[model samples]
Target: MSLPRYQEYKNSGVAWLGNIPRHWEAVFLKRVIKAIDSGVSVNSIDTPAEENELGVLKTSCVYRGEFDPSENKAVIPEEHDRLACPVRAGTVIVSRMNTPELVGAAGVVRQNIDNLFLPDRLWQVHFKDAVPAYVHYWCQTPIYRAQVQSACAGTSSSMQNLSQDEFRRFVLALPPIREQSAIATFLDRETAKIDGLIAQQEKLIALLAEKRQATISHAITKGLNPAAPMKDSGVAWLGEVPAHWRVGKIQNFAKRESGHTPSRQHPEWWENCTIPWFTLADVWQLRTDNVKFVYETKELVSELGLANSSARLLPAGTVMLSRTASVGYSAIMGCDMATTQDFINWVCKPELTSDFLLYVLRGMRTEFDRLMMGSTHQTIYMPDVAKLMMGLPPIEEQAFIVSFLDTEITRLDALTAEATRGIALLKERRSALISAAVTGKIDVRLS
Candidate 1:
């Protein structure tokens, strides 16, 4: 679908839609709309207790081009005489103090509730010739948002705001009132359909993730033998383990060890280190395919006291468990790297397969957290790690289970990625639709 081209004029370095119908005109926001400061103050007074007056709209109440009344904060008292930002049902509200990305978040007020107060952080827009809903959708477009962001100023923590006067100076292309209403109605139906489709894709993605996890957990705990007798594994999470499987400490197959960081004061040690040093942040995602930095061999051996330690390069199949901050997260090592003290490396023995052990450890993370020590900083001590009992199968069975899970999970991941991409495309299309309709690229006037 190609958009119709029209003559354009630049305002504050932004192009405005021109060559519009003779009746249409490009006007400054101040000229077409009035920004009123409804001084119904909430910070100075106490909140009311009545259920009817229990809701007050804050900046967060408006999000993603809609007003979420459920997110409203406090209610206004009946005695409050000050007219809280009085906006009609169709008025547009834009957030003034949000981050640059969210600075100009705009939504139309679809319904009117009595005594609803708009916090000072939000700016209410009342359009003259154009429908408020149409303008609201226009402001949500990427082009307009970039303009708003460029006009804003402030530090990173708190974004600078646009005063009513500055907001009035904003230039906008205005179609006839009937055209504006027609465009808004068209967008309301089209965007709602797109949103519904995106939501369905999101649910499918979640279902795929859950199914993948269940498949991995089942294969690791139970052998491939369909007729194997099941026995209670004592732990509620490990309900029925294969009767032939043995439960023993992880230390039986692998050893527990901590990592050390070379002194930062001596930059030389870190400068030449070729060994990959991983911190807690590095373990945030499930896959660590791309490591950011590497450490020198000399620094790894001398400054880091890893000479005898050798940074535990347990082949490509090692399973790693995170033990701090974001605890209980586990992933199979895609490559060999040295992890910080915040991890308990599970080096699988010759009797165990790496992929099989990875799945088992991933399933056992919750149990590991329950056994973790330290009140101030949650940690899984080596002793606690040594006490964990796991059910293991023979080496050949482990390989079979790993191969089955690998094939199944790979399919699930592909489906999940496709659904995610579809959702993203829908969102982009919705934005483009809104931008085109409001900018007069599409004719909304009915014959």
Candidate 2:
């Protein structure tokens, strides 16, 4: 997939665009025949506008050099007068104010939009001489991103502002009109092939995850021997279980404990921290790293902090379930630790093991979704958690199930990791292809 370089080249005097085809021209953005117009901010609802209604664009409308008209909100009738910058074809929409990484993102529209208006954080560039698609692709290159990063302004690092003057000063290496169209067409075709491969890998990853969850649910609900006699478990989610398995409330087999945070106002309580503290911050380890046991925590609490607060130093092997904010994630504690109020801890009795309980919790994702409450922040209240039930297998069977699941999960995780790596490589190739084509690093006229 390599293309031939141009016959002759010359330095453009710009660091990003080191060398260009002899016939190509490199010029500041303002030199092109165009006028940049910005839009005014308006009050709008979160819902997108209907075909007959007017809408105001959101900062998310442009991503990765692509335009999404649907990423806009419905504008009420009163704010229609403030909507001056109407979305039009043959123009580029650039985000003028956003987070540092996305401040100068731009996209080109392929068709004339009727009722969509830009917001104050966006600017519309109407090109008179340059090809809109070429300019859009150029905006995605690292060259444009570096320049935008250097020229960005704002008091805070999270949100950056890009001025029209600074944006216009961006320089691009341009080819003739026919060559520009050819390059854009070449990218559209080649990138589509790469995108299709990436999509297949993503779908494979999703299917592997579903299979992993199903495997866990099946092993925990039914015994390894399919011929084992079955009986009604009484619970709707736990339809039936092995005849010999014991069925009862979850609280009967384990002691349910809640977590608490130390008072921030007491400065002395926070000093000289030693004990490991499990809080919502450490849930990311379970969510992404796919680890079954939590050995370390992001923060630690002092003995004074534990004494002053309602927190308790639970022993190793305690099962921790995040009950609020980020709910449903569970793991076994690898060492003695205290926790914040965000988790629901459990100490299994002699009849149940912590590893077995961890599997049961993971298998009950549907039940978690059903019992969770609240609009903005969902939580599994103590009362609902107390009423939960499970089918208890024999100790030997519980140990066997844990061992079988550990093996299966390891295989699935390896497959998922491979697919994820494939996606990363595809994205890198896409970015490199776009950068090389837009900057004349590789001649794409005949690609």
Candidate 3:
């Protein structure tokens, strides 16, 4: 798959561009661009659907390599005139402000678009000679990105801004117009092939997740033997269970508890904290890698903070379910921890297994979401969760179910991990290929 190289090379006198094709010219962007315009600052926030005439492009609109109309922030009709001229097909756009990793992301509109205004944080330019797609691809190169990143600064840690003056003076390594068109066409074909492969891997990961969920849901609800006798559990969501299994409310099996946060005003309350303070942030950690054990948390509270607040300290193996904001995510505490009110935890009785309760709750995530919606709620209340009914099996059967799931899920996890790695490698190759072709390390003009 190696491509041919140009016959001759010459030094470009730029750090990022050690050498280029002898025929190519390295010049300032200001010399080749007909005009560079920045969008107006529209101090407005409204839903996209509410404004039909036009919307303002969010700084994120061009944050990636492609034009994303969905990232637009809706603006009122009165603000439409703020843009000097509406964006058109084949216009090169760049982000003037973003994190170092994403600053200077550029894309070209592929079609004639209407009713979309640009934000002040973006730059729109028309090339006097070079192709828009060629410049767009240039902006994605590591050398160009590194140059932009070196010039950007931020008032706050989260913000990085590229000034217009610095951008205008930036130099570009350019090919003749005909060569630019050929390179752009070649990249469009090659990257699309790579993107298709990445999409297939993504589909595989999704299918594995679906199969895993179904396996867990069936094992927990239907018991180990499919042919076992069945009986109605009286829970509408859960139709029936094994005849020998018992059905009971969540409260019947465990004691429900909540948590609280200490005031931020008291710095002394949090100083040199030693006790594990669990909050909603732990739910995200669990979602990241399907993390099951909360062996550690992002923050810890001092004994003073815990004593000053209503936070309750619970032992290891307690099952915690989110009840506010991002509801339904659950995790088991791997160690004794104090928590915030965003969660409703369960301390299982000796007769009932904590592993069994955790499975039942995890299986009920979808049901929790459904119930949360039925109540028209942004958060699930404690009373509604307390009433959730689950089918219970003997302690031996509970242990068997957990063991079987652990083995089967681990096997599927391996397959999923392989697919994830495949996607990552494909992405790395795509970036490298683009950088090599656009920077003239390889010649892409031939079929």
Best by TM-score: 2
By the TM-score metric, which is better: model 1 or model 2? 2
How high is each candidate's TM-score?
0.80, 0.96, 0.92
Model 1 misplacement above 4 A: 1-19, 36-59, 72-88, 113-120, 153-160, 260-271, 287-302, 305-317, 364-388, 445-447
lDDT of 2: 0.89
Residue-level lDDT for 332 in candidate 2: 92
lDDT of 1 at 80: 53
Q: 1-447, model 2: which lDDT tens digit per residue?
A: 898788899999887678988899889998774888788989999899999999999989996568899999999899887788889998999998889988999999999898999898999898867889988888888899988998985446999888888988889998988899999899889888999999999999999999998998888888788999999998998888999999998789999888999999998888999999988889887575368898899898999999988879999999988889888889999999988988988999999999999999898889999999998899999898889898899899999999999999999999999999999999999999989898787888866
Model 3 local distance difference test score: 0.82
Find the candidate with the highest lDDT and give its number.
2
Could you give candidate 1's per-residue lDDT for residues 141-209 as a string of tens digits? 765775686678554656667666666777777777877788888888888899999999999988997
Structure candidate 1, residue pairs in collision: 272-296, 273-295, 273-296, 274-295, 274-296, 275-295
What's the residue-level lDDT of 292 in candidate 3?
Answer: 74
List the global CA lDDT of all models.
Answer: 0.67, 0.89, 0.82
lDDT of 1 at 422: 96
Q: Residue 238: error of model 2 in Å? A: 1.4
Output the better candidate (1/3) by TM-score: 3
lDDT of 1: 0.67
Residue pairs clashing, model 3: 259-341
